[model samples]
Target: MTRLRSAAAALALSAAAVLPIAAPAHAESRAEAQVNAFFGQYRDAVLGQNPNQDPTDVREEFMTSELNTELDQWAADHDADPVFRAQNVPSGWSVAYGGSGAGHSTVILTEYWAGGGHTDVWYQVRLDTLRIDGLEDAPQ
Candidate 1:
């Protein structure tokens, strides 16, 4: 019984040691969380998981009017979905806080495609309103 208790304690200690290091990896900043939530809903809409919701409506809710207009033009120009920046929806995605300055914050969204490959979309968010104001391909 004593040996079992010692082994259990060792396991517990190991878990405890890993908890702090693992926690931050899962931690989402405010900007990241917002972007993540938006993407999740947008993806659902695009996939028709939410029958009542439209993907364009989702974009309007999260993005600035000017950005929405720009996205529309971009979609026409590229002949692809402007938000995904691709013709197909991604299989997975992640959002991260890039940086903030001049009353705006940057959010980096990496989209994982089916089969293989990924795309990074950079979003500019207004700090005060937290509204996404710009979306563009990752800078060269």
Candidate 2:
């Protein structure tokens, strides 16, 4: 009887371990969503990571707002025409976020086709305002 009880208890414990549990969502409407949307748009614009891997050969573009804004300012400063700028500027990227806290986050991205290797992007988000204070490759 003792051995039978021990076996039954073990089985019960194992079953509990495999049982699924409900959990709340995180990053659904935050930085994480932003990252996902960026990549999804990228895949749509170019046949990304498919038969035509790294499709920047056709055109260049950035999926992040921060980078886009910076590029626009640079173009304005240089008096660069839009068509010429698009053909020469860096584009096509993938990102991996490091850690996120109350107001700060880190994202590492592949910068191969963008003219170099990989880069780590840092971000400051104001949760209260639900807005990104800033984002850049180097520390701000």
RMSD in Å for all candidates:
4.4, 8.7
lDDT of 2 by residue, 1-140 (tens): 99999999999999989997768754444554454444454454443444543433222333335545664675587675221233343355555666777665544444334556444444444445434445444554
Structural similarity to truth (TM-score) of each candidate: 0.82, 0.37
lDDT of 1: 0.91
On residues 12-72, what C-alpha lDDT tens digit does candidate 1 reach at each position? 9999888876343556767787788889999999999978789998998999999999999
TM-score: which candidate is best? 1
- Model 2 vs. true fold: TM: 0.37
Q: Which ten residues in a row have the lowest lDDT in candidate 1?
A: 20-29
Q: Which candidate leads in lDDT? A: 1
